[model samples]
Target: MTSLVVVGSGIAGLTTALRAASLGAEVTVVAKAALEDTATAWAQGGIAAVTFPDDSVEDHVRDTLAASAGLGDAAAAGIVAAGGAEVIAELISHGVVFDTDSSGRFVRGLEAAHSYPRVIHAGGDATGLEIQRALSAAARAHDGIVVREHEMAADVVLDGGRARGIRLLRGGVLHADAVVLATGGAGALFAHTTNPSVATGDGLAMALRAGAAVADLEFVQFHPTVLHAPGAFLVSEAVRGEGALLVDETGHRFVLDVHPDGELAPRDVVARAIADAMAEGRQVFLDATSLRGGTAENAAFLASRFPTIDRAVRAAGIDWSAQRVPVTPAAHYLMGGVVTDLDGRTSIPGLFAAGETARTGLHGANRLASNSLLEGAVFGSRVGAAATSAPRSRGRVGPDAAGPGPLPRQAPPRADLPFSRRALQRLLWDHAGLRRDAIGLTRAAATVASWRASRPAQVADAAAAEDDNLLLVAEHLLAAAHARRGSVGAHVRSDDPFTSGKTAPLPEATLIGAPC
Candidate 1:
């Protein structure tokens, strides 16, 4: 049997495994934690697609590219946008339940940057959890799939040009026909993020180690309003979609100063606005009190749209029916990763990537809200089917000579001297947070280069996350940010704001490359 290994167990990994198994391929799911504990299961907004009859593929595609800034790859964006409903239908066929009205048509939701109300939802805002339930149930009984929970993929075992297997913690050297790494993003590299602790950009880091190219590493998106209470709870954009307003400390509406879309402007702009307000000594709030532009009844409308947000508000000693919920910016999404083609094949032959860790060019500078889940599901299946056909000779690669391997590791430090994972994350958040100056970027790049310069000596270490991995991933991101001398999309450089003006055309495009 040609064994195909899927190294992530989220929506992307699960869908890929299911599709590949159905194609009569042997599949194994390797996860760092429980299968359901991923960035996908925690998503709040529903998938965006042209579900309703009035919505056209052109409309959805245009809106998506418009939101992508000028950096969108037009063909990739069009393919994903047009394929949206087909994937949603496929999800339904797998027993994933999306919300529907009495007429039985899928109930839709609206978010910013879209021209139509085409997002298919589930039990209000629990869309991610509901879809996960369906995918997980399918994987459990998939006779051809072997699930290795808590089995973390430490590195891709690359011999020459193609992938043969991976080095994992639970199972040492597991040979495979091909590999797919959909292990989410590097959001955990920040002090505050909505992503699970496991989301430390493992897939990106692993791929880079194997000489794969990554793109747009600097464009990290921050959610405009995550609850500022302990642990930094997420206040979904669905709350704003349901008519909440962004107000200041004195309860004054403040979003209009940024964009006409008001509370619904793209995430990066909104996040910076909220952060600036907080820095000015004025508290930020999402006032669900009076609704967008309606009456008293509009105030309570948010409760019906997003029960999770309402519940969180209640838990935090506030009521959406009568008060403003406190919120702040939190690191949310990364718009860059291992570069891949439309079929999900990365720069490395026999290796593929999907989800947030793969820059498929569908989400250019900024991702449209809720489009991520839809993208993951669609491309992951494509990766799986193609991967199933790869030659599984295992070649000259030897077999495992051991039992269950070492435990999966967290992010590692560099060779000679070191800092903890938390320390590395703190350092990124401090100097590389929202604003950027030459001094700050130089310091970050110099530190990462120093780390990268130490990798050749530590190749003999058995630890999963050697200092080499951290330096490579960190320096890749900083190098991209350094080359992108202008502020566009999620890359906000405070010192170089006016670089991309009309008089001077912004040739400011950065593609896949390794750090020097």
Candidate 2:
């Protein structure tokens, strides 16, 4: 029987494991933390799909391409859009319940860049948690799957350009026929991020070290309205889709001046607008008070439909029904990762990547709102089947032709290092955050290079491994951002002139850490 090792416990990882197990492969899920501790569990918006009669796969694909700003792969986007409904149906069959109207039809809602109300949720704003719960339960119940929690994948064990297993930081190797990387994104690289603390780009760094090609590492989507409070909670774009507005301190809709679509413009546009407003010393707010409409019924509906946001807002001492909530863009998603084909095959053999860790070109320069979840499901499902059925043959050489074999590691210093993860976080935020320039990128790259040089030749623990991964990932991101030199999509360069076009000229994918 073929054995597969899947890293991560997010929606993508879980789905891939379950699918692979169902196909008669013995699958083991190794996660750095418990299944619940993932960026997917923190997601507020629901999954996007063509569930309604009014919605068409063509429309979904078109909107995705438009949001991508000419950087999206049309073929990949179409696959995701067309296969979304089937994946949604599969989730439902696995006991995942979605929100429904009084008449018992699946309740669909709209989000930015979506032409139709096709985003389906469960427990209102608690959609991600719901999906996680369902997948986790299904995986746990399956007999073919084994769950390994609290274990970090220290490195990818490769043999002559082919992936064979993973090296665990705690010690031990799990040899497998295939390895699926679903380790989520590196949003936490930024100081202000909606991602959980665990999202430190470990998977991407592992792939890079093992000689896989990563593309578009610079196009990180910053959510336009993360609540600017103590906890920095995320304010879902569904709020705006439900008729809320983005207003400045003077109660003027500033997004209109930026784009005709206003609050519904692509996330990059809105985030840049919000950042511009904040840079000018103006505070941005999400005003949902009009949704109350002076009616108790409407107010109750608003509270019930977004119970999570309502509770968070109320706890923050601001009632959305009575006032506006302060918000700012926060690092949310990575649009590029380990370069992969539609089947999740990366540049290396015996290795595949799915979910946020893989760049399948579904999301180009900017991701359409709520498409993250769908991409995970669609590609996760595809890669599982493909990974299991493929023959075990010699794979193509990665950029580094040297085989990925176990190498001697140097242990991190026992004493406290001058640079800490918190300091790294602040460095990335200041230099590689929402707005970046040549000067900041250069300094950031130099600083990270120095840190990398200081890193212990060996990783002994999760902290040390993560620190090393952060430095490597930061270097790649900074390099990519520096190479782009133009403001397009999520990568906004204040130093460059803005193009007055609907899309950026097709961007060449910025590759890092690969041999010339």
Candidate 3:
């Protein structure tokens, strides 16, 4: 039995374990897959840390608040920007080598938001992998840390009114005085995503089941430049920062003609512009050929940035250096998650959350460029330090005092469930893509609801999971989409494109049969 168990081995989880172990606390990390396969590994853009000489904390803070669309917590955004440089320096100390120009100065790339170049990357676009490799290596080597790869955390065990430990399958029970949930995001619920398959809202679902308060479920960020093809591999927005244009089927540069900011506008604007162009029977392209400093060398940079996307494009009989890669919007980030304070403490004592799974209001309606990774590092370390100092339980948990036992199993995997997930994905794309109407949303919601109601009864009781976990996640997302009514961020409403509430808050989940 471990003293502290952390779920998800991405940057958030790795940082959490590292900080705690550094403070002399025993830590155990449980992951569903190899440490390298988490969503953090798939991030193509660099981490947006304010490191440039001209950059100011206020400017960075303002950019984040602007992207959040107004409901963003001002205080939290400030805290995030304040710690930007320190965290970057900390990563450097940990041997996370970021990319630099030939002169050895940090090579900065621009993404949506900020008034200047303030992004720090690793090897051009493999920031996620670089950071993960360093942190994972450090965590595994720590004497106080124990990593259990392939062991998935079923749920957070709750006893009385506090978090006690986490239960798993490979290992019967791992008792802990405290548990840190750094589970990634719910990006996998959507068919077209920049996230990995393991990001199935496990942290969000598990935290909610453990009675943690979550927020901003309604705000989802869809990266506007994913390559629109068979697999829809994402081409990084860094391509735009490096001088690419969004053009229409007529080969006319369109974004410049529509919005003043053109291709450089925020993600919401670009995604909508592309959708509108598609609605008018036009396909959009990133016109990189005509820009200054645009050449095969630029494509070489892109190829280096995302090897997976590059290889896939090559297989599709296209040379990106000389040709335009087709583009579309795919679900990318969840701006909200389990609610937490600056230190990452959840509503429940002894439980901490960080990363995309915890909606700390840092990214309000929409997250700025690379702040997602920075948030995972900045607050992730703070939370880990806080958890390390948490007072240990005076007495061991007795059998009668142990938490929500063995935890609850997610609905098991099944073949038909994949079909249901795809169906829901299509429905969401059709109705809730860049725009939405009450009629389509209601229809989609009702269909998903009917499926949920008909799912096996065993799922209602955690006794033995029935059906598949994917279906449950789909049901909840559809339900929440139906509950929200506004055109804020990515949760746009066609029936009411105008804002509804002054600050439209996301609805609290209403589980049909939660195992209390």
Per-residue lDDT of model 3, residues 1-516, tens digit only: 236888889888888888888878889888877877788888878888788888999999999998777778899889889888988888887789988878988988888766778987896678888998888888777899988887777667776767777767444667787888887987766768888878778777667667777766667788888888877777778878878778877787777665688777878778888878878889888755544345667666657665666677778787777778678888888887788988999999989998998888888777888898888888888888888777676665655543342223333223233245577667667765667776775565555555555556443432223124444455545545555676776678777777652333223323322321
Stretches of candidate 2 above 4 Å error?
A: 392-418, 500-516
lDDT agreement with native, every candidate: 0.77, 0.85, 0.74
lDDT of 2 at 362: 85
Model 1, runs deviating above 4 Å: 292-303, 394-396, 399-418, 448-471, 499-513
- Model 2, 60-163: lDDT tens per residue? 99999999988899999999999988988999988889999899898888899888889999998999998898999999999999999998988887766678
lDDT of 3: 0.74
Error of 3 at 281 (Å): 2.4
Q: After superposition, how far is residue 246 of candidate 2 from its true place, in Å?
A: 1.1
Which stretches in model 3 have alpha-carbon errors above 4 Å? Answer: 291-312, 396-419, 457-472, 500-516
Q: Worst 10-residue stretch by lDDT in candidate 3?
A: 507-516
